[model samples]
Target: MKWQRFFLLGSVGLVSICILLSTVRNLVSINTNCPLSRVDKTTLQPTWPKNRVTSSNLSLNRDNKVHVIIFTRWKYGSTFTGEILNNNPDFTYFFEPIRREVYKNRKIHRGVFYQDLIPMLHNTLKCEFIDKNYTWWDEENKSLDCRYSKKLQNSILCEKSTIEKRDISAYLSKESRSRMVEEICRSVQHVAIKTVRVPDLKHLKSIVTDDSLNVKVIQLVRDPRGVYLSRKVTSDVCDMELSECDELKNNLNYWKDPPFWLKGRYMLLRYEDLADDPIEMVHIIYDFLGLPVPETVKSWLRINILKMSSSSKSAYSWRTKITYKTMVTVQRYCMDLLLMAGYKPVNSEKDLTNLKIPSIRKFSYPLMPNITFGVAKPNTV
Candidate 1:
């Protein structure tokens, strides 16, 4: 009887060990076999991949719902772009859900940081916002705070002003609000997120390549000179340096040769062009994403354009204030990116007078032509 008891105990222990080993294997596989290779510091190879999506164990889903990330740099009119999607009744937009995480944990090791960040993004995309607790970094106290909870609630669950007039709170308690958010998340056909927190293109691999999500990326870029002028006027510190510009140029070059499978997964849009022709640009973006232009988005754009016109603010208005010295400095630092992006340099304020924001009409695939924008055709080989 004692021998039988010992054998049963040993069997239980073996089963536990096997379970632990399987879990470890799954975790290891998630990181080790990812398509985006780790950053090789010695060779300066970027941790982000602009080439191809690596095939992995992630299972793809046949559901046709679309997911989009507006991958952009700081102060590049991302808010305006995000609002375009936000106004669409059919789309659910999340604004910078990972900003606090990225800012507070800047010193964390890159690989581990990405591992945590990628999953956080996946959860956000899945509308698992309320189930998890997140703390935003308070710059003044240098501590994590839940001050953004209300903002998250408004951005994700409900816009207070929109619902307040209807006395939503009389019936919708906190618990019910969460349930409402979950149902909205599940029923929405499209999910859109705008973020500047992502450090590299490689960080997007798991989400974009996952077969379960029909993810698309819109890389928003601006004239570096315009970016510099805007930052200078607002006293905003420039996060991008000359070295980063060089890296960006190299990344663009790499993207010029992306694998065939990645052809229609992403596209580039210029903030300047979008500003010049908001309606046309939005229409093109809708076409690229395989979405029709909803009436709500049209009304929002019309109202927005009128407001901007009445206020005397335009995308290139800052160019007049940029000093020649500042122009030279900006040109020197951003020359590679300017040339690669087909932006012409302005030597003087007078040069800004006749400068035209390039109009992009249709994008062609494979080579990603200098044309405005491109999306993959459904049945293309």
Candidate 2:
């Protein structure tokens, strides 16, 4: 009986020791896998490569592909300006590709933030259309249709015959949809994407720093007072205006002290400048892109400029629509942006309507020599 008791006790002790060892191994494994635990708190983080690749340092030619990011906020004439580039046959244009992703993930996904949207742009520039986050369809759970983009219609999946068959009976496969967009993207030599989702230029650090991509950033800004008046009326007008001004402020602060990579890779263009003289702006934009102005683009300008001229929304229509009270409210929220962008503040209704009182102060935008292009008000900067 004593011998049996000893053996039983020994077996029980061995099993307990084994279980304790297994739990400790799992704990160590979990710690090792944790990203925070992997980094040593005492050690400094590694820095990004500081090799500057500005336009001056690197020549843009027809031979080398270029990526252009038209970074601006809503109601800033980005769509109109981007349309100018889209008219060029040599360039493949994406109109607000990140809009859906931003809209879908904003409320539900707490983990996704403003900076997280950069990867979508990066992948688009590289012609990688297969994003796990992107539902392969522009609209979620909608009918498989190519009506969203005329560009996609040119792809195989959305070709007239293919689309007809699918419309009648078959649905577009996920693989086919992705392939369609990818093919269109890869077939082009140059890619341009206009995004209002990226509010801060600093979020583009990863994209600009990448040596593989030849990116040119055009920071398009407009008068905040005008923007407020022109924007689609929303319940939270003041909040929206505040967000837009904050973004402009962030861009200006970034450019004031830009990193080496961004020194010659960025240019600032005012919406007023583009609206007032589009042909000249097109010439400047094409020169910066290192491409000659195609006749197609010239034709597009000639026709569209006339249409815009006839439109009710003249560049300064805000002068008439904005009441003195609204102007004051916008001015109060966006004083810094107005000051930076060279917009004159209006104190009274008379000041608001007086065409003689120019909204934008006279400023020369020298594309080269400086990044801000002399737009920054001296006192504000």
Candidate 3:
């Protein structure tokens, strides 16, 4: 009986030891498998999910195909800028995909916060243009004004058969339309979206940083005075209030020290420079994306640039029209941004013509959090 008791105790001790060893092994495995271990040893935690799609993943999946967003403020020559991409056969442009939704919902204003729009734009980049996500201004009339507008219907990716059949049966069910749109989206080599509703760069953080989509942002900035004057001169004559100008200035300031995630992903282009040399500027942008300058785009530039130049004597056409008091207000409001963008203040219309469009300096990105700045120069197309 004593021998049997001793044997039982030994067996229990051995079982406990095995269990202890197994636990140690699991702890070590967990430490080894941690994703953070591969990154720099810092306490900084990731705000986004670990499995989020990244540029690396995009390269592997799409053979380096790109997704471009022409992010611009309202009336900042965004239409013309978007045209550059629209003319490219390789690109399928979506113009203001968020406009109708915002128009339909009063709560969804132009300056609506970033967090609210991130999820919507994320799905949009993935070619998920569901009916539920979008609200049209004329839903009662069954107007296709939002996504299925005449211009977008004629885009390179749209099926001619679908566009031509316009009758009772032609109006496909929501599911059928969604499937058709998704098919076109997936078939395209590249997708370009242009928007005037984005209030700031931060609103695009998720889409631009997302690995699933190869996203690039071309931030088109026009002179504040030009934007203000144009707004004032419009038929509605809505003067851009000081608050609006201040908000714009704040947005520009935010980009000067962009978040670390945005490094090498953001590019700035002045409206004046683009207006002055549209062909060269367009080439530069295409080169930055490592894409060939499409012949169609070059042809479009040649025709449009001539028209733009002939209409105005100088790029700063607002200088002559703006009152002295208003000019002073604009100068004061946009002083910091103007200096950062290398624009000088103009006291008279003569100064506007004499002002040479400055060559934009190459934006530099830092290698690490506090390491040396590296030159990720824009390619001259």
Candidate 4:
């Protein structure tokens, strides 16, 4: 009976040892692979592909996911318009992703700008940032600032201490941050990019032509007079030799002869129109994007744009605030483009200052040769 008891005790100890070993192995496995398990394996490319699959083509079909590009220039109310989509939970928005490169570097040449900037835009939109050319220097780390990108602020990475955080210094390696952002980009229902760097719509032909990317381009334009006034009062973001009128003319000419591919994919939204009726404009914007207007956006408009203080409204009332001399200068340079864009040039100081004398031609559509404003066709809007 003593020998039987000894054998049973020895067997129990052996079973206990096996269980401990199995637990140790499982813990090691979890520690080694848990973080990676969260990452989508398909996007774990050794290097970015020559042509990457856009976010729209990933888990969902192209029809279900849309990529909206807010293409505009400086002082054009791109920031305000971008917030419309940025506030939406469905969109993973990138605010002026190319600003540091374009504005800080001041590289706007057709050849060099297209070669350098377009690829960056494409890689970012497609959620691929692993290329050797995509390195960010110390100064360029401003792109990681949550102040610029509210979506980044909403991420788990952003801490409560500061609005700005450097990915290279504070959080993770560049590649790791890229992987995280790419993961976030892929998981979202839509991707939206607001850029003031794109001077000409024709430059985006490559991105727009990608059938896999359900691309909708909203070209936001403020009256060049308002743009000039804002630029004068505020410090200039960048010193560009090209005037606002020149850029406006360039875009208008491009709109006139937009390639067949651009027909249904493009939209021209006036800043005045949006400022006049934000909710209605948002609905039109949603209609253009083929999306149902989310209640969150309506709530945002109410809190932000609608309930804005009189003092704040006065700040944006450039039409009233700008002096007669300033108005004449802008109107002189931008007159043809202004008339084309449905803005009236004031003849005198009274007309410029008077709220009754309409500066913006209300209900007038932009002079687009092929398409109507706020209408979305099969390919472009």
Highest lDDT model number: 2
Better structure of 1 and 4 per TM-score: 4
Cα RMSD for candidates in order:
19.9, 22.9, 16.5, 17.8
Worst 10 residues of 1 by lDDT: 52-61
Candidate 2, pairs of clashing residues: none
Candidate 3 residue pairs in backbone clash: 53-211, 53-212, 54-211
Candidates, ranked, lDDT: 2, 4, 1, 3
True-vs-predicted CA distance for residue 368, candidate 3, Å? 16
- At residue 380, candidate 1 shows an lDDT of 19
Q: Write the per-residue lDDT of candidate 1 for residues 1-381, one digit (tens) a residue.
A: 999999999999999999999999999877665543432436532233222222210112135467888887788888888877877776777777777777778899977887887777786677665655544222232232122222333433333336454333334445555555556666667788877866567678778777777887787877777777667643322335575566567646535655444456667777766765565567567655766667777667655655544322446665666676666766778777877665666755566554454312233322232222343321211
- Using alpha carbons, what is the TM-score of model 1? 0.65
Q: State the C-alpha lDDT per candidate.
A: 0.61, 0.69, 0.60, 0.66
* Model 2 local distance difference test score: 0.69
lDDT of 1 at 31: 68
lDDT score, candidate 4, position 53: 34
User: TM-scores of the models, in the given order?
Assistant: 0.65, 0.74, 0.67, 0.72
- Which pairs of residues collide in candidate 4? 264-380, 264-381, 265-380, 265-381, 266-381
lDDT winner between 2 and 4, please give it: 2
After superposition, candidate 3 runs with Cα above 4 Å error: 1-62, 108-114, 130-132, 136-151, 155-170, 233-241, 311-314, 348-381
Q: Which stretches of candidate 2 lie over 4 Å from their true place?
A: 1-62, 108-112, 130-133, 136-150, 156-170, 232-235, 310-313, 367-381
